[model samples]
Target: MEAREKRLIFPFSAIVGQEKAKLALLCVAVNPLIGGVLLKGDKGTGKSTLVRALANVLPEIEVVADCSFNCNPMNPLEMCDSCYERYERGESLPIAKRRMRVVDLPLSVTIDRLVGTIDVERFLREGKKALQPGILAEANRGVLYIDEVNLLDDYIADSLLDAAAMGWNTIEREGISFRHPARFILVGSMNPEEGDLRPQILDRFGLCVEVSAPMNPEERIEIVKRVEEFHEDPISFYKKFESEEKKLTEKIVKAKELLPKVEISDDLLKLLAETVINLGIKTNRAEITTIKTAKAIGALNGRRRVSLEDLEKAMELALPHRLRDKPFQKPPQMKPPKPKDDKEHNHDHKHDHKHEHKKEEKSGSARNQGIGSLEQNFRSIEAKIPRIESKNFDGSEFTGYRSSRDVSITVVNFPKGIPVSYVPSKGEIRDVDFYNSAICAVLNDKKPPIKLEMKDIRVRVRKAKAPTLWVLLLDSSGSMAVKRRISIAKGIAEKLVESGYIKKSKMALIVAKGNQAEIFVSPTKNYWEVLEKIESVPTGGRTPLSSALYNLLLLANRERMKDKSVKVRAFLITDGKASVPLFGKRIKDEIIELAKALRKKGIELNIYDTNGKGINPGISYVPILKDIANAKVCKI
Candidate 1:
């Protein structure tokens, strides 16, 4: 590594704010057996910087010299072939010490580039097959950093999942087979808006932390000044924090040695289980990860036994990503009270006496009302709120849902707003990604070639499918429906249009009426088209809800075939009064089957029932639609 490159990197200790993120990374360093840490937040929140700085802060590790997999010198069972061979030969193996590195896994990396593959260059030179270590091999005993991990190719992501879980990389392709220990701290950072990490990948991470830009003005100013200084004179800026970095390095080394001694109490373990249960967590992995993290934190704090404080901190870092966050519900922040002088303490006590007197007076009323009672009263009232079969959507308040203001839903898995390469299909060759195609060509070739062949050439492909397509299916059938429903549908359509605008999603409208579905407005970025069509859509026709859904399914399928990465969600605004179907005995039955099939095909459905209140809350057909579609149902 060049001095300039080393200097340019912002030191871990020097990073302002994001203390939670830094702590999570440090916990992993102390106990890499805690799986790994995931940093989730928006761009430019110092996630990548904190991850890279881990390489500089960790103590150097010993490895068998010239071992491709960096086999640990002390652990023979985990040694690579070369290391084991030398050990079996009773030969003295050279030991090498090196600083742990942050090996980057680029978005363009393929299976061959990630796991080991046949050495194409060496094969060409000697005409003999040899294993060329990939990024996983290089990352052994270090840190494998993946920035925008959610954007990684599905194939590469699968490899990571297996290797991460098994602590070994096993590859077999193109007449080459090899296995090597690949135990490393896996650090991944991503912006949730781009795409969600697949569940399997999400499960592999031991700790997940959400970071954000510092909200404090003073903190932001400090960040800006420090960043400016670093960019202006990286060497000078780094020099200022070199002492702090060394101190952190020494701390990490000590923590690792102390980790084995750290113990967790049964009470803390029981508390962790209760917390997970209260949070409605289904997986045991969360419990295990929390315990491991708490122990690591205890070790870091130089404690032999894990405390409640350490457990609380561990839960904070481990549970957010694993659990479904209830809106407006926040965990109790357990911050230690600041020390106060005698005068200040006396003032607080005086205030507490007055508060206690007021509380005592209110206690009678509270007792009468059974304020402290833990009964099923709230549950009964909530149950009486009428289970409208028309709606079964996530109840969490949409992130930016404001009735008096513009509305917005944070749509995930949306098409790339920019040049995001989620789909691993081949496209034009970019210089750096050419190696992937070259390796691919060698694998596909029937026989080993003495020289290159033009026909075997393949180019690297990336998904250019940017911007999601929102298909709105509106029901405008029957005279009564037209008079009572059109206006409700129109109002709902307007809200959805505003939401689409905020989410930067393309909108399309399909109106179903008179035994047919017509594309009122084609998919476009303009929200105005949705509003314009809503105002002039023809109503008072026989319901053809099935046909409308079928149409939406066709559109989704076309988009899926063209580019599987594009997110497509259909909003069905209807009273669920389908009197006609393009084909089938019962229109409702056909619609249910179609809805289920469409959902399976990856198009999400949200049913917005425009039916009126009281006697007829929602049509029977709505429940069937909700069940089959697995959709979020809402009353307009």
Candidate 2:
């Protein structure tokens, strides 16, 4: 059944328009030492299809027969301890040929499942190491594919980084340790619109390619026809590409054989180093990976000498993601204007020259002044706002409507949930942990299934659902700058953020400033970073309240799609004024419609009214906003 499914995969040779992605995969296939490839693009862009199809085109690898670790029989360094012992004893290891596999790392994969777990019972009873192979072990000499890599948990990503860097996985537990070869070509794909990986992990990947749906009409039509044909008759489609696939496989085999012989000139090497330095890439891995990738590319093209073109192509795949600036970064800071002399000002503006220039300079200076003043005001009011005692913010603490009840296996000893899974025991065995003892016993001992024992018992790990995503939309428009209202909004926002942080909730920020609304910060657990970003937002434009709400709706929908059980609570810190109309509709009507839309989506809305009695009177739009949004209104 698995073989048939593998046969039906879309042919790598038949994939359309993702030349860069295909090339990156081929480079890694030719030389796993090139590190790995990260495919970042939108949905339906063939990221997964390309990765799965890559296996069919890869040449067969020789492994020690019956070895769970896929130990390379010829290389003692790549073999497990058991295999190494046999090699040392002058035993001829049985070898088997098999196509390289594409091992998938699921989103819910636990650390134990990723880096092999130990059988405590076997260890204690036999006084020997009994290690179960993990995803990395199974992926040895193969491809490790992680879809939606950007959404991977921090710890899981760290585990991958450590293993990928060392080409080995070490499992240390309770004073016992085991190690195994974990070398593989790591291929990861993600939609950048969802989120981004941390820079440290991103650098671990040797190459990065951004893919998207083909824009050319002809190419798109061709892609559609090819996919439809495959769906109609997968076997026939596989046969059609069999020759091309074989040729590609043969080419990869040749490249791997020739990779060691391929050489780069010293001048070309110097050029590579100089190029990396110019790109401002700090990691030494960039230079090393680029050099290896260049050699692979040369070998793939049946060349022994690395050419300038190979170096250029290698750099093209290697440098883009390594740059300092990443996607969705905050816009650059506004520089203060240079003072203009009266004569120059008069020359530039003939009519009302002095008055116009003075007004222009004052406006720019005032805008800067307003931002400075807002920060200063926030500092003064910050202390007055009560500070809660800092506690470890766990997501499970939040409970309300739309909050997820899905079990989170990430947390241990979750006080109020039923056990859903059994993890490796951490020295403690409870009465309720007998659920998987038999299975553990069978896996630990080579003999027939035995009775459950305390040593074989696993730990019961359970937790509440995923955290609520809080989206804070701050009004940084010109009107809010009046009476230092924007400052008050910032203070309220900071307080809300702090409150959520204490609950271990994820927070996102959207600022309604200038002519548009921007996502200042994506949903993140780093509340302090969000607060810092909020402090720097300048105030000076029409209130794009509708725009802000529209963006909030989009963000909420995206988050919901990523995790269906995610509860989104949006806080609109504004004076309830909508000066900028989205879709050219009435400002009041647009705001009300968007609010209703948000409410219909089951997203909880809250209005933090910054209105006050002063020279600039409040518009009092909060009452209507509250009614339409079904929101809770808080006066600040």
Candidate 3:
């Protein structure tokens, strides 16, 4: 590979076609504090290329001298212990400003390289010493890029989440207690096909842009032509765009300065919030980020203040992943077409099975003539019907009111010797279930048993609120690297985030791959990240479906409040593809046992077979999961 410096592009301004993607990235670069953006779409969609091209648009940064990690020199808030100690002792500190470095992390990296680990050389050569810096240390004040980020190993994902959240990396590995500033813009790209990024990590981004290959032939041809030209001579092709790139660099500087003046009104803020919530998209962060992003967008457009149009533009992008109404809006309850008045109801009631009570109409119409016979039969049956005594005919026996469409059935009396009595059982009880469990005591001793009335007995269906938890177990297996996998996974993930499947229910994700299962993101509105992670998973390894699920059981416990929040659910989104590329045994029994344990925990397990047509041997393992508790299978 070429060195990082030489591979860098001309500038952001000269980029063609993908203007929206470029502008959004510029906003994030100008204000790292705005969080980050999620770029979604398909493979060869330029998700990776757009992000890589970002280095061209952004200006270089300054850092502390002699720091390999490129630690910021101006921000005292982020200095290391050694640097801090030196500063306090009145030492003259050196500084240097250079092009900002882009640190790309691979999925297979060990925890040692991500966080920090004891230096084996130090231990061996110096008989034990201080810990050494890791990749996080190098990533400070830079771009930490992770491609196929959705398939990241569990331990690695967790460490990155912790670091990104706190802006500081605290290592607890191998009995070490070291701390360092770890503020960096986390840029991750994934194709949703293979799997999704965890919800927790998705919320960290302030902006998210979805990109795809230009559908138009003209744009595609241009894309191809540009690539071919670059391939022929990168330097010459980049030079052709260099002047335009510099002009765009100046635009970023102005956007940054003008950002403070860019205003978003309360109305737009509310719209942003409402739109996202209306989408049933989870995450307070989306609302918060929209406010910030709207301002950045306003500044980029050279507007001093936000307008309805500005709000519209911002909300269009900000609310796409957040709208609840888009997917799960309940069909409005329709009022039954007006029933004919009681004049008709009375006519219908006039007819009795054995008798008739008829009303003669002077008009002599045939339809009205039928009403006359119906009335005669009604009177006859009413007169013959016997009334049961000592019954509380009051509707109080019912549990709750019914919808207008529901027909009500009431029992007038109980058979002789049979009583609707409450029976106490020897176990813990729920008040509602207890009510539903009641049965009338019946007598089998007499033939043609006589009937009696129960003073009070009521059971009704009441609307009760019980929140559900949904887990999305995304397959990070290599097969998911296919286009179908990407499209379906993206669509499914987006829909669920918008709560199309289970409304008002929280969702979680578990990414499973070679002996690795990680919460790439958490259950929240940062779903755009989930989609990107889904598309970006590279097809290079075998799937460790079993181990990933087992690890998920542990996370579910934490998420469901088996240790914390009592609400818990699990969604296993996979083509059900398994692999032996890793050490874990590729056995049907192991995966079955894992699913069984998941079922035992009361975790609502759903296996969505994302594989389009046939089943792979890895997918065959899902059948064995039936041995586990409360598991369901669906082809999503």
Deviating ranges (above 4 Å) for candidate 3:
1-4, 7-15, 270-282, 324-636
RMSD of 2: 13.3
Question: How many clashing pairs in candidate 2?
Answer: 0
Candidate 2's C-alpha runs over 4 A off are 1-6, 118-129, 173-176, 325-449, 452-459, 462-468, 477-479, 482-636
Best by TM-score: 2
- lDDT per residue for candidate 1 within 1-636, as digits (tens), equals 644566778888889988888889999888888788889888888889899877768888998887888898888877877777888899787899987888999988756678877776766555576888999999998899999997675557877889988888887855666788999999999986564566677777888888899889999999999989988988998889989988988988888888888887664565466556544567888888888888888888888888767877888888766663321112333221111222222334544454455455544532223211212222232343343222324454222212332222332223211222222233442322223435555576644444545544443333332447888888877633643566556555655766665455668899998978888887765454466677677778688777888889888777767756577878888877777867866776687688788768877787776665656532447777777778767764
Q: Candidate 1, residue 78: CA error in Å?
A: 2.2
Candidates by lDDT, descending order? 2, 1, 3
Instruction: Give each model's whole-structure lDDT.
Output: 0.70, 0.75, 0.57
TM-scores vs. true structure, each candidate: 0.63, 0.64, 0.52
**Candidate 2 residue lDDT tens string, 1-636:** 745766689989999879889889999999898889999888989999999999889889999997999999989999987888899999999999988999999987766678876664565455455776789999999999999887776557878889998998888744557788999999999986565566676777899998889889999999999999999999999889889989999999999999999998765665566445544457788778888998999999999988767877888888766654322222122221222332212223342353355455554433233234434555565654333111112322112223224324344533223345667666544423432665577677744435666677676666544558899999999888877678667777876775664344688999998778999998886665687788889999787877898999999888988877687888888887777778998877787788789779988887766665445454556777678878876655
TM-score of 1: 0.63
Top candidate, metric lDDT: 2
